[model samples]
Target: MKNMDVMLLSTSCIQSQLMKELLSESLGPSITLVNQHTFAYHDWNKPALILVDLANLPTSNQPWELYLRGFKDNISTVLLNTQDSISAQKLLQWPNVYGYFSHYEDQETLIRGLTKVLKGEHWIPRSMLIEMLLYLQSIKPITTTSIELTSREIDVLNLLSNGKSNTEIANELFVSEHTIKSHLYKAFKKINVKNRVQAKRWARCHLPLYDG
Candidate 1:
């Protein structure tokens, strides 16, 4: 019943205009649109949806990661790209990215993806989905014993798997710096790991890091 507020981030002017037109035509005029080259993660006014063209954006190691960490539970994200520009291997690892639609896809597919995303469903390409399943199947299962971890410890492991440092993880989770170190220490002990890198490897083997 309520209108959706959407933010569009793209380096291509044409792609931005096309998305605006398609969204307006499909979702009606009540939807609000904000076009920007870049956005700060701590902006007060959060949008309901964010559409980002990953290929067009400048090469940063973790731009999407930073954005996803900032708006993890609050906003839905759509990653737009050409099929050649993005690979299925990388796409499956983005937990917060709600969908991936090709720029060359038909208008109907794009509209359907947006609608599905708005309705709280993930929209992945069929081919990409198959590739993801295959990749999952190809990975050899770890035969290590199960370890008991507290919820907080799991959270710490998840952040560590994403290549976040203690300070960054602490800042993102709103915990004191000392508390983060404490959690990490306990997590390493529980998982029988010597360091953060080992913990990350263990997590990737056992946990569904990107299926949240």
Candidate 2:
């Protein structure tokens, strides 16, 4: 595992430096630590695990998403400083995101989680994982005939399946929240699904954008 790169992305210079030192001292020479800017000038040919400090992200730009998107599918990600499980779950919709470290976690816990993640295992909290499993269990497969969706409804459902909230979707589409709800209601009717999770499962099965 010598020279394995683990990049830490945090907008706060102080936080990035402190975390780099802490992680380097803790994990030893087997892991190479990179700051947010180091990877830009270098070609990362091997699969790397990215540690993103979500709490320090710029509220306006969301540059982290763009940075993560630049990586190949082999890139694994673990979100750090997550405030709550709901937001963490939503963020996990990204295919590369494997797990998260809560804001309240101590250094020992953080190190333990990172070690597990390095071993190609998820380090999510047990409670959060249970909640997620319950939600997934509730999403029953729905069989429907040929369904016709308006362009706007398709757009709404796509964002919804990507774990976007109604407000976020409305802002992205530049429409009112009420209008987004109307679109969702119509889409739900068309898809013959009742709620967001079911709709998301249906989209994963049927929608070309997210179809596996």
Candidate 3:
């Protein structure tokens, strides 16, 4: 985060100002303040870090809509005062999110988390990380002794489990994306999984012995 600007976007004047002071103390001249409404008019480059105060934003247009409205995927993002809400855990997994500030954390902790994110490290609560791991670990193995899979189907599942997009899998397997999708749809039906994320969990939990 050295020699880079950090942008703060929020609707609340008080919240934005308070955060500005806190961040300025640690970040010094690298912090720039911008209101939510004036962002489109600003002629600034994409910042090194985009810190968002989600609490002050309006929620009428779907919950995470405000947060994602002007976010840049190239920049690291940190949510302000996320606390322990059930939905916060889900938000943590979104792309470009480097960390979050829990409502329960002290101001000093917020600075530390920001510094960690600036240094290219993700800062997340240990409990949430463990919970996510346990959830993935708990994907019940599908009873599939009666089912059969083609070699291509196994290739699709293996690649999908490794986080390859359908297009990437298709490119790797020398097939069209449509063919990959067809394979995935059939694989989903056979394994009783609904989506790629679920399929990945199932593969991780059950596919160790699979030589695919």
Candidate 4:
């Protein structure tokens, strides 16, 4: 791995020097410090991993997404030196960022993180993953208000939401069990749900205006 370049991106001169010394001393001497101006010039070296010091760099203007896009399947990316781990949890959503370590962590921990990342393993904070899951659940749209469901489907869904079994709903609506199942299947498709529980949640949220 001595031939492989490890790109360290940063805007601060002092930090660039410090991180460079750290990587070179702890990891090895193969580390190359590069900024936006020099990064394009070294594309031929083909850095194996990018350790992004987001605390210094103006991340929005860098087209970092496109830079990652151009790397295809080769380069592994990691983010560091952030103020908030909870808020920074969103970066885990990106496939390229396989590793994330808060800059405040000890050098030993960061070295362990880098070792794991270079071994093709992820290194995110455990709490960040938990926060990410809760955040995803919070943002996940139920689509009850957004979806357009048919009246017959709504009827079946309403009964289903009210805890009526398929046969019970069919009897209450004076429809055949086959007809009720058909309505349920269609409702599930329209609302983008799979099972009776999800269908019930959708119906309860969306059916306030429903009379049928």
Candidate 2's residue-wise lDDT over 34-116, tens digit each?
54445454466776777877776653223335344435465778888887644433654544777888789999999987877
Over 56-125, each residue of candidate 3 has an lDDT whose tens digit, in order, gives: 7654223233334324354567788664764442553344677777667787788887878777788877
How many clashing pairs per prediction, in order? 0, 0, 0, 0
TM-score of each: 0.59, 0.57, 0.53, 0.53
Query: Where does candidate 4 stray beyond 4 Å?
Result: 1-3, 44-47, 64-66, 85-89, 93-95, 131-212
> In model 2, which range of ten residues has the least summed lDDT?
59-68
Give the runs in model 2 whose Cα sits over 4 Å from its true position. 1-4, 29-44, 59-63, 66-72, 138-212
lDDT of model 4 at residue 2? 34
Best by lDDT: 2
154: Cα error in model 2, Å = 11
lDDT of 1 by residue, 1-212 (tens): 13445666665477666767778789554443343323553363544576776656653334444435444455667877645667665664443677887767787888887777877788876777788788878765433356777656766787788888999877766668899899999888877899877988888876653332
